[model samples]
Target: MRKLVAFEHMTVDGYAASAEGLGFEFTWRAYSEELSAYGDEHIRADVDTALYGRATYLGMRDYWSAVPDDPAASQHEQVHAEWVNGVEKIVFSTTLESAGWTNARVIGSDVEAQVRALKAGPGGTMQIYASPKLVHSFVGLGLIDEFRIVLHPGTLGAGTPLFPDKSALDLDLVESKAFASGAVYLRYRVA
Candidate 1:
């Protein structure tokens, strides 16, 4: 069986985005060497595929496929980009006609059923990226097996929230790590 996990960055107040998505003023605060390395190893060691919604998929496709091979690009950045470009990507989107990435497949409907089949099959860890809509569906539909989030410190005066609506969930704290970058990484097993 495959485990479905969500990897998200949230504010201290638990909002995933500040009005718009991960850009503009709300861009990733600062890159921590420790945290970035941890994230890279976390994915390289276990995760084999990425699950995304239309927006996240497109954004990632554009960004990762173009990690510049220049002096400005760090070794970590180049390696991370290569990892993303190599991994399989499954996108759930009704409006998207074709997957922009070669390693990507688009599912227009019956998302839950298809995802269930994916989980039933033999596979490595599947990580859901920055897609709040997909996250909401996976959580509310009781499909996700684990939730891993990095909680950054700050209160976005207003923005898209991680959990906009309240739904009772029973979860066990599987792991927690605090970084010198004022970020706390948390992993929870859905119960």
Candidate 2:
């Protein structure tokens, strides 16, 4: 069976995204080579599938789809882009008519059923990629098996939160590392 893992980059105050924009572009202003390598190691080898909400799906597709052919992109960027492009992308959205990326599919309804079916199948890890809303939903449904979180140093006073108010979870720490960029990586198994 495959495990459903949720990966999120969040501020100290627990906001996954800031008020101005999605947090990807600026959430980690102190992003370092160490952090980059960490991300590459996590996503490049173990994960074979990427799950996303409509907003995150469109955002990532627009950016990552162009990296492989862009001359100016860094070697790491290109490599990760290639991995992302090749992975099976599952987008959950009621409004999205189609997922335009390669090896991508959209599940418009029966989210719990579809996700459970995928988890029951044989595959590498399936990761929830930076979709806080979807993360919340999966948490509510008790579908996420593990969580890989990068906790950045700063705080966003107001923004999109990673969890809903009054949400609770019981997790057992699996691994942890602190990067030179003042960011901490934590892996937890649902308990």
Candidate 3:
């Protein structure tokens, strides 16, 4: 069986986004070279399938797809963008009519069944990116095999949290690395 990993950048308070809303704006304060390299390494070494909700899928498609064409883009950014562009991207949504990016497709319904089938099939690690609602659902269903989180030093205080309020998960720490910027990368296997 393939591993289903939920990757998230979270505040110390456990929020994935600010109380204002869910987007890229709230999570980059503690970004560092170590964190960036770690992300790229994970993508290169572990992930072959990327999972996202409609909003995140659209956002990532726009950003990563354009990185290769940007003259000012760094080698790191270009390489990661290339990997993202080639990987199988599965967008989970009911309203998204199409996945316009390359190697991308839309799974409009039957999330639980489809996801289970994906996990059961042959593949590299499947990573769920910046989709808190989808992550929560996966967690609730006991579908996530691993949790890889970059915990920023500060707190959002109020925002879209990473986990559901009433649910509980038992996890075993697999790895932990602290970056110079006070950000910490934690990897846990669901127990």
Candidate 4:
């Protein structure tokens, strides 16, 4: 069976996004070559497709579509952009009628069912990035096989947390890595 992994970077205070409801664009000011390389490698090799909620899908679509047009885009950035734009994007949304991006499919409101089907019939696993509500639903349904929580050095104080509920999850830390940016990556599997 194909695995479903939830990947997100949270702060030391445990918030994925800022209190102002911002994305991860300005969250990590520190740059680590190792982290950048890892992200590039993971997206290109391990990810068969990208799974996202409505908001994330639209945001990524808008951002990645113009990557090639950017005159100042670096070689690595361009490569990463191409890989992400080329991947099969499955967006779960009740409001989205269509997607303008290439290889993008807008799944209907039944996200859980669609995710199950995707997991059952696939080549490689799907990676979901920074979909808080969707991540909560996946966790509640026990659909996520792995959780990659990258803890940044800074603290947001308050924001949308990775896990907002009171459920006591028994997870086993399978892997951990610390980068030069003071970001700690922890991969946890269901125990």
Highest TM-score model number: 2
What local lDDT does model 2 show for residue 60?
94
Q: Rate the local accuracy (lDDT) of all candidates.
A: 0.81, 0.88, 0.87, 0.80
Deviation of model 4 at 166, angstroms: 2.2
Across 1-191, the per-residue lDDT of candidate 3 in tens digits comes to 99999999888888986756445465567787777888787633788999998888888999899999999999888888888999999999999899999999999988889999999999999999989888998988889999999888897678789998897989999999888889888999999
- Per-model TM-score on C-alpha atoms: 0.93, 0.96, 0.95, 0.93
Give the lDDT of residue 22 in candidate 1: 59
Task: List model 4 lDDT by residue over 1-191, tens digit each.
Answer: 89889888888877777756456743557557788887777533577888888887888888788888998988877887888888988888888889778998998867778788889995797889888777887889888888888888888777778886874678999988888888888988877
Write down the TM-score for model 1.
Answer: 0.93
* Model 1 lDDT per residue over 1-191, tens place: 99999888888777776775453244356448988988887634689989998887888888788885556788988888888888999999999989878688999899889999999998899999878778988888888888888888777877666764886788899989888878788988988
Clash count for each candidate, listed in order shown: 0, 0, 0, 0
Candidate 1 yields a Cα-based lDDT of 0.81
Which TM-score value belongs to model 3?
0.95
Worst 10 residues of 2 by lDDT: 21-30
How big is the positional error of residue 130 in model 1, measured in Å on the Cα after superposition?
Answer: 1.1
Where does model 2 exceed 4 Å of error?
none
Report the CA-based lDDT of candidate 2 relative to the real structure.
0.88
Candidate 4 weakest lDDT stretch, 10 residues: 19-28
Among the numbered candidates, top lDDT falls to 2
